[model samples]
Target: MGAHRTSLTAQLFRRMPVGRRPQTEGGLKRTIGLVQLVGFGVGATVGTGIFFVLTEAVPVAGPGVVVSFVIAAVTAGLTALCYAELAGSVPVSGSSYSYAYATLGEVVAMVVAACLLLEYGVSASAVAVGWSEYLNQLLDNLFGVRIPHALSYAPEADGVVNLPAMVLVALCAMLLIRGASESATVNTIMVGIKVGVLILFIAIAATGWNSDNLSDFAPFGVAGIQAASATIFFSYIGLDAVSTAGDEVKDPARTMPRAIILSLIIVSTLYVAVAVTAVAAQPWEDFEGQQAGLAQILEDVTGSTWPSTVLAAGAVISIFSITLVVMYGQTRILFTMGRDRMLPPIFARVNPRTLTPIPNTIIVAVVVAVIAGLVPLNWLLDTVSIGTLVAFMVVSLGVIILRRRAPDLERSFKVPLYPVLPLLSIAACLYVISGLALVTWIVFLIWVAVVLAFYFAYGFRRSTLRQDVDDEEVAP
Candidate 1:
């Protein structure tokens, strides 16, 4: 262990250009602010799961699913706090990957990058699949028609092609190719649409609440609650999207931390409210196999389809935006890895024409499209939760490492409670991870080993930093 630590430290502390560091790329673009950051978090977080999670979670914990929501929220909040400190200290676009490289070491950074790629890449595909379901619902409600089951479902799920989902991905790719940005204004619009539809849901659902539904809240027992919490944990995955905009935030010392905590609080509250109302409007058992559950609840409550139609439309729009943002994030992280010579150079080449990593984005879009088209939503959601939980654990640990190794480094925001908070963050992450299936852990371990092998075989030899270090010693 001691020798391993020495090698890791040596790899991490190797010298490279300070001015041209990946963090210093193209100056900070001030296109986002606190409100916009919060909007991004809310927009990325609100859709898909809240509309559908109760169905999956309720069967596990019954009415006690509300408690699961609170537990997941608290875990997410702790990780987000650690993310805030790292984001503020590093102020980079690669999120946890960049933070890990600066503080943890190259091998750990590569592992974290792999996890992030899974987190954002798989999540984009997952959201696209969800968007397709909601779009079909909207069509059925408004036009009295629906896409054929074979064309609308995944191949594994006995469908031919998820045409609507593929179409959504294509449209988002075109928008990205056209250099369109999801500005703060657009995020605000998406957030408003999402939150407004949810508010409408809560109001309509209030009319149908039955106290009888609260009985037998924990039919599944403690084990069931933990299992459901693990699944529901996916809904909170993007809460740290707020911290990723660290460089653009005003008064980041105060604003960055506040935005993260505030976004988590608001999103968690909305999630619990939605869960409680959905379960109250109907028995917990009914949520199973119920796609677009909230919108359906509105339909049942009003005895009319318009309210549900509107909600479905809102989900369609908001979920598309989420896919776009998450895809953008995945491409950027790969771009950073490429710049560092960890992955192939193709990922690093920014298009001079678009000023975006056009090739990188396309590659990610294609991969995600395939996953969205073929994989089941449940598998996608579970893999995403595993990747995100591991990455969050790394970031929390990275915070403690940086504080101890480079105490004098300037930090715009420091996580409150110091060592204790970060330690708790790790514990919470592990607790949720424990609920994941043994198969998921096996798959995760294999994936990490493959990444580490690549790091040793190619990345170590091709690293730009190693080349720079050699050149400097030769010159002297």
Candidate 2:
């Protein structure tokens, strides 16, 4: 046990060499500005989930789900502030993985990387599954024919492969492989489509709103509200993607901070508006077993399928973009791990032609595709929530650590209320976590242990940081 403990410590705490860090491949141009950054965060964040989350959250809190949305936005707001500071300080692509490495030790970074794999990778799969649902809805409305449930859902549900989801992942992977960049212009266009759809939804649904529907607020009580908050949290996951692009942003000190806050406010406001409209237009209890809930709401109100079809088509396009951005984030984090020699070196290798980590992207794409095609949406959502919450907790703690340890570091943004805000963030995270099932927690722990095991078995000896230290000792 003593030897095992030693080995574990050695592996997980492995370090990186400052000299070996890869140069910016292809001398990639830094063309992103504040507008572009805001667009990326907004585009990557506001889709599929918000359209569907209302169906789940409203029943839990009734009309009180609006308050729950407020709670979630506040928590996400605090975390985004912390992320802005770290991103400005580190200015790297790996997001929290890069931040943790600079402030915490190597071992902690690996664990965070593992959490990210679940966060972005699995979440992409989840989004693709959502896209599949909307795509099927769009087809049925436009063509009066529906794909067989057996051909459209996972085999786990007594069906064959999810062909549409698999195709979506594969297409995204190809774009990524070809270095198809999601420039600020493209992101802004996508954001426009997303926002326009929601506005259309609200405008149409408002005609059907009846205040009586909100009278029985909190039908399920505090327990149900808390449960709903955990689910709603999924919609807030990509706010940090804004922070991850810190290295390339012009005047990051100012841009990084504003973009993060602005994006959060815009997204939260839209989400709450959508949720309120959906609930007011129809009874909250009827949201159960709803697929393409927002689009369905439109159909019910208009007594025609055109509005629903438009929303479904918009969802399909916007959700696809979200999956691509998220999947991109996942591969970059793994590349950072590989670069540090904490995982296989292959992950860090950038392709000479694409200047991206082609192999790593392929591996991530394949794994996520399998999960999307086979796994159930409910399982994917729960696992993603757990990973994201833990990672957010770490970022909040990192903010406190960096403030104390390196008080002189230039931070473009700082968390307001200091320790109070961070403490509140942590508490809210735990509150949401408390609602997760026992099985989810058990699965999370097992995944963490497996990551720690890999760190000890391989990362210890090959760590670039350790080798650099050894070389310094023998220098003439």
Candidate 3:
């Protein structure tokens, strides 16, 4: 009986061999370079996170949203380092899921995959929802006819359907179906346009800066700041998306870490600059229930519609890239899972001409588009934050575990300060996670439970790792 119990324990924690997925035929092509890789990170991280988040975060934190951005940035910076090391070391498709399978075993890997679905999949839907808002603003600016509320907003927002959001998701899916390299090139251009537009906002908004807005910086105090920090951490969701391109990244050891760090710096600067400029331009009390976001702020400050038009135009283009890269990450992770037989084989099947997963992208797009068309945007922020924070905590822990288990492992990037940095990464994630509301926590727990139940019933028996274990026993 003791021996049988021990055998069951071994089966439960079995790890997949490294580089195993890349060994398969018709695998992802390693064509992404440093510039395009940074584009993927920035493209995915910079979008509605900054453009749409202020509408929700400012109401919660008031002018203290600046502090919230700092806290979230620090936490993201720490986790980004952890991700960089693992991406360089493992250099595979699944990001943290691949890392966990190599160190923590199958159960933990499955949980990581669930977190990733929330991080990439749900966030893509959330950003698409944000896209609809900017698209309305852009239409109003260009054609003088905004999309009607019935066709523009989600059901939760009292609209019949979010057609614009669905259209954005579909467009991104089509671009992704073409090829990764082509998508990256287009994203790079969009990134450039968006960054320039944000700088334009700062330059113009700074002219109207009133010192009086700083009077009540922390109306909600520590709790408000923490809550806002958790909410806006969604901005950094795509930083790790760079690592999902593990199989397709050129000199991943060098490129992945560079892209992650570079994008974090770029995103952090823009978020803080935008937050500070917005708060300083208008009173914190005016930030509540704002729907039009940065462009509206520009209109009020400049007393001219053209500035709003320009900002909204940039947002429309940039947010499209965000949804594209995030959805891209979602498909790649599922592709790896499908390769491992953790999911249906169709997710792993790549189109020979495009060398991309067409069916998987289509499946992901349909589900995400449905979500974008139905759910409210604010709820998505909390769900995405908790999932990403938890996933980051897992990655930090995985970093320490891997170092101990394989001290001789060669890594292109190592977390500076060793265990201390990884420990702080875990602590930072916990702090941000604590700020999430009880309802959000309940939802997150329930989602994780459902994924675990699926894993036990299906993944446990059908996973390739399970087959390998049974074969090993029979061989002896």
The best candidate in terms of lDDT: 3
Expressed as tens digits, the lDDT of each residue in 1-476 for candidate 2 is 12223355553454332112434654223456888888878877898457666766676678778777777777787788788777666666677777777767788987887788788888889888878788889999999777788767888767787878888899878776765344456657777888998899999999999999999888888887777777778777778677666545677667877887888888888888887888889888788768898899999999999999999988987887788778777777777777777779888787776666788889998999999999877777777788888888888888888888788877767787898887888888898878877888898888888987887788766777766655665666
Q: Could you estimate the TM-score for every candidate?
A: 0.92, 0.92, 0.97
Cα RMSD to native, each candidate?
3.3, 3.3, 1.7
Candidate 1 to native Cα RMSD, angstroms: 3.3
What RMSD value applies to candidate 2?
3.3
User: Which model, 1 or 2, shows the larger lDDT?
Assistant: 2
Task: Show the colliding residue pairs in model 3.
Answer: none
* Candidate 2 runs further than 4 Å off: 1-29, 180-185, 247-254
Residue by residue across 1-476, what tens digits does model 3's lDDT show? Answer: 12233366676788876546554568788889999999999999886567988988988999999999999999999999999988888888888888888888998888889899999999999999888888888898889898899998887789988999999999999999999999999999999998999999999989989888978999999999999999999889878799899889888878898899999999999989989999999888777777667898899988999999999999999889899999999999999999888998999999988999999999999999999999888779899888888889988998898888888888889999999999999999999999989999899889989999998888888989777756666664
Give the residue spans of candidate 3 off by over 4 A: 1-6
How many clashing pairs does model 2 include?
1
In the range 334-392, model 1's lDDT, one tens digit per residue, is: 87788889889888776655556678878888988888888767777777788889889
The regions of model 1 sitting more than 4 angstroms off are 1-9, 12-30, 180-184, 243-258
> Candidate 2 has what TM-score?
0.92
